[model samples]
Target: MDERSALGLLAGWVDAAGDDAAVIDGLVITTDMLHARTDFPGGTTRYTAGWRSIGASLSDVAAMGGTATAAVAAYGAPAFDAEEIAAFVDGANDVCDLTGAAYVGGDLDDHDEFTVAGTVVGRVDDPVFRHGAAPGDAVYVTGTLGRTGAAIREFERGNVERGNELFRFEPRVATGRRLAGVASAMMDSSDGLARSLHQLAAASDCGFAVEWDRLPVDRAVDAVADDDAARRELSTFFGEDFELVFTGPRAAVESTRGALGAPITRIGRVTDDGVLADGDPLPDRGYSH
Candidate 1:
């Protein structure tokens, strides 16, 4: 069978989860990054996905509760000669340089699609796994959700307030750095909150009790879709969120919240009840691109 394609663009991040730094050491590579970059700035969008690849992988690093220290990205080209490939590398290099990460090295993979592969190296004093959540740990998130996916939906629907907030993802580097061991379990939620929570619960062998009413929504998104159905659609399965969802003891959670000096609403708590809302059960689903 041809190499299987996944359901969503964000699925790559989920697949790269789990700890084995030694195994992933220098070999963690991505073919999609090069493909996206080579087509951009000259494609229909007229902008390469090189930077986007950086942001996406960086977000993955944050989700793993680590900060990217360096990255090695390579490109595959069929038509463009060495010069064009060099420009692509330079462009990607700029992203790494700006983020204080080094461009180490990587090889090229030539194929039908112009491909880009980015292998990132990160460091964490304490690796944040998907599990480790205790029964009473509270669920919290940094920043709001759904704006990026909502923008995509709006763009596809023939309207274009197209917010680049999610597309040009700003990795929560500092946030991840600070949250290292603060939360018993930490993850950057590229998928919707529902999905991340569900995954975390399953991994930690617990459930999430959420309060849907307190969800932090972006007004830019809420403005166009004010109805309940639209709001739910935007907030629920809308993917590419890239927000941080971490859990910890109530006291530790409260302390970390105060120290972060940012807004983190306690959307729920982990329990054995299996992701509840008040006393009722909730659907633990992730977002799709």
Candidate 2:
């Protein structure tokens, strides 16, 4: 079975196991794993790798509307270089600092390839969930999309520095917390917008009517994509943007639009059934490993 099926199996025994993070007694906890081959692109620095790896787990905490307290990583490499190890730690600490958390320390080991497993602990009085959306709620997405796609293109063109910079994204910890106050349902778009929407729909037992023109396509995407179709494909399916996609009552959404620090666009509205883009069915496609 695939990862989703495996998670489903686990959900049968563990309550709240299907969410971005598991919450117990007001503590939010999550973990994530990354590989050098699939996650960190060629020319990616050890520093960027550390940030991306640990930031992923922090994103899970953000999805739960929790304040990250601390983080740790299990790092394994074929052979550890002292300089590289230090750079990794610096990157992890920087990301945690930006998101109001601390990276205490973690384990190290020798392995065939560079790998990182990150765990984050957070706290929240009321955590949001993916299963709480309802029809008529407005669907919102923070920040622009297709940054990772743009970064990949840059990497292909030998713009390693720019590519690495793009790959290093701040986990939307603050944005998620803000939305938590207003969002009925929420999730991170690390698995691509289309797949994220599908997952949210399945969990909430609802659908979405998304307007294609409403998508907040990143400007960098225009530099890499050849045409409108290419732009839409990259922005919607490429994933790795690390932005929050959430839903809330129309009234609540409109009221809080101006106050949110990040730029969030109202791209759609929740519906009774079927994910749609401009009235057409949107394919459930996204990043999967």
Candidate 3:
């Protein structure tokens, strides 16, 4: 079974297993694990790896509409290099600081390959959930899409520096908190926009009719794909952009415009059933871990 299937099995017994993060007594908590071979591409620095790993868990906190407070990581590798470890911690600290959080340090050990498990803690008064979307709610996405797709393309084309630079995504901790007041349902697009829409549809017992032309695709996607079809494919299915996908009342958009530092684009509206993009069915495919 894949990760989602495994989580399905666990959800049978775990009440808090369904959401992006577990919330208890106003505290939001989540954990994530990554491997070098599968998660980190070749030429990825130890620093980037650290930031990406911890940033992932923080993204979960963001999905729950929480203010990230602290984070920690357990690092494992077959061999230890002093310089690499220091750089990893530095990256971790930088990412946490960017989100107004702290990197409180973690454990390290030898392993068969480079691996990192990250955990983040946060606080929320009224957290947004994935299953709260209403039929008339407007669907929105924070920032742009296809950033990771462009980065992967650059990596394949030997533009290692630019690719690595693209990999350093900032977790939307503050954005999520701001959206909490307006968002009825929310999630992170780690598994790509198409898959994220499908998941939200399933959770909220609704459907989405997304406009192909409305997606705020990243400018970097143009360097990878010039045609419209290819650009849409990359932006929707490539995943790992770490942007927040949410739903709220149509009127809520104007209230959040001046407050959110990032751009929020309305791409669609919640429907009675069936996920569709530009009038055609959109497949639930994306980055599977």
TM-score of each candidate structure, all chains considered together: 0.75, 0.97, 0.97
Score residue 230 of candidate 3 by CA lDDT. 83
The lDDT of each candidate is 0.62, 0.91, 0.91
List where candidate 2 sits over 4 angstroms from the true fold.
none
User: Distance (Å) between predicted and true CA of 180, model 1?
Assistant: 1.7
The candidate with the higher lDDT, 1 or 3, is 3
What value does the lDDT take at residue 57 in candidate 2?
89
lDDT of 1 at 280: 71
Window of ten residues with lowest summed lDDT in model 3:
10-19
The CA lDDT at 193 in model 3 is 99
Q: Once model 2 is optimally superposed onto the true structure by TM-score, how far is the C-alpha of residue 210 displaced, in angstroms? A: 0.4
Residue 31 displacement in candidate 2 (angstroms) = 0.7
Candidate 2 overall lDDT versus native: 0.91
lDDT (10s digit) by residue, model 3, range 1-289: 7889998898777766788899988899999999988888888888998899999999999999999999999999988899999999998998998899999999998999999999999998989999989899999999999988998888889899988888989898888998887898999999999999999999999999999999999999999997987898789999998999999998986688888777889999999999999899999999997
Indicate the residue-level lDDT of 232 in model 2. 86
